[model samples]
Target: MFEKFRKKSVVSESSQLETLREVLRRNPEDNDLAKVFPQVMPLSAVSSAWPGPIERLGDLPFGVSWALADPQNYFRYVSWDMSRKWEASGTNWRGLAMENLTELSRRYPYAGSKKGADGRPFVLSLLNEDSMGPSRLLVPGLFQDLFGDDYIVAIPERTCGVAYRNGLVGEEALLANDLIDGCFKVGTEPMSNERFDPKRFWVL
Candidate 1:
């Protein structure tokens, strides 16, 4: 489903340069720029690097790894799906004791009852580039426009936003995702089926 769509945008090279400048401006004293922008730029930097619809990822988790691998591969957001690793492990990964996250999404990206100390329910939402407004920018506001307050983590390149209900923040939700027994990570979001065109500013 995700593969069928194409996100079109004429990225202004100048705009990207400006965006990077703005982010670096936050900390002018840092002598080493590499320290600030690590191997995989933090989720926050991804938001800041582009001057598009989505300018920032407010409180997303740290597990996200979307950095510009090679300048030649411009406009491509390098993605490493932890879930895919499990998918490769066969039943050992997919057959976890948890719910079939993929199946739950078939109906509605809703939540279940409170399970942990935080008294929160796991919530999942999707932010799609095809459905996103004209700019193809995965803006933070887009999550609110779509799933309201239930969203947790958002993968802009994949164009999917995940959330956990109640007060369970991204960290807690991700923790629960790992700790819960018999829990299978849901394949609801479009982590796959994406191709990034190096020549273009858009990832299709």
Candidate 2:
């Protein structure tokens, strides 16, 4: 079961990378790279919409709220599943996503850009930090390296806000807010972590 889970995780990361690359390729000339990178969404709007569930402990550390902006707005909320007991097994969830993004860019250099309904170029992934997990330490640099300085959007979750407003209610909505807050940060320091070096990301 453990091996299977690892393999599944790897596959999932690869798929996400490919998806991001495809978006980049479609909108190669798109000017709004900032919109595609990870950042935090505002609480006011998020509070009004589907917030998801909340934890009694308050908030998680690495929560992530993401959206595919452009042709249509699609949203996803991410959090660490500590209940799975992966730490003892030597699994690093953070590294999984980063490695996947890196690999995808190498395999497909012209991903990230695509045309929207308006025929204008647009980026696909728009991430917001949720206050439900550890600091989103790797997000900014990951995006900057994969995309570009101009393309990265590392706004704190307090500013970006959530995309959806209905569907989720009660615990789900509150949980969603906590998740968003956990993922969101106030500045670019988190990206400066050793793992996300802009120099390493530079293609040429």
Candidate 3:
């Protein structure tokens, strides 16, 4: 039933990413990603075991630099977006995000959704420390609450808990953390201050 999405896995990140890109390339219909995150293709592979590449700190996938960045656009490529099947189920993620953002915009004033890719709805919650209001915490849950839609709250470098929903797997999140954690020295932030390809970090 969930043909348009992939969930958690136990494989290596490189292998999964390669398989995902290959599947999307072969299918040639998931052109929606070309608009925003053209780097991320679709997936059809089911294997959960892969021989990961030997990685180092310099070789790790650099996450988006949170230093003086626009959280609105930054989040569009990261937050929870509904699979088409789930949308057909009548749970519209974009609508919910817009509604919540509309209400939250009354105070935060920096919430919106950018359609860089198709199918995936990237929700933005940009607020300063002073106005860290409900939207920061509530919006993600509201979007991910659709039936059969599973997600996890991930705080990238003290930023808001941007929901990593869409077709992302918990294993991918783990791989990201593992790569960053294993690379950096103790206590150093995994979400780096340098921007890297989002496709290298997570497979959507």
Residue 22 CA error for candidate 2 (Å)?
A: 30
Q: Model 3, range 1-204, lDDT digits (tens) per residue? A: 111112334466577457644543454232132222111111221123211111121233222210111335432221112234335677543344445444543545333333323544333333234223222432323443321245433333322223333444455444434423332222122233232332333321
For model 2 the local lDDT of residue 163 reads 23
**Model 1 vs truth, CA RMSD:** 18.5
lDDT of 1 by residue, 18-110 (tens): 765555345323222111111112234344444322222323221222222122323322222323443465633222211222222333332
Structural similarity to truth (TM-score) of each candidate: 0.22, 0.24, 0.24
Arrange candidates by lDDT, descending: 3, 1, 2
Q: Which stretches of candidate 3 lie above 4 Å from their native place?
A: 1-116, 122-135, 138-140, 145-148, 169-204
Candidate 2 off by > 4 Å: 1-84, 109-204
lDDT of 1: 0.31
Residues 107-184, candidate 2, lDDT per residue (tens digit)? 433312333455533332223222211123322343344335533222223222222222335654454444333434
* Pairwise lDDT winner, candidates 2 and 3: 3
TM-score of 2: 0.24
Q: After superposition, how far is residue 44 of candidate 3 from its true place, in Å?
A: 42
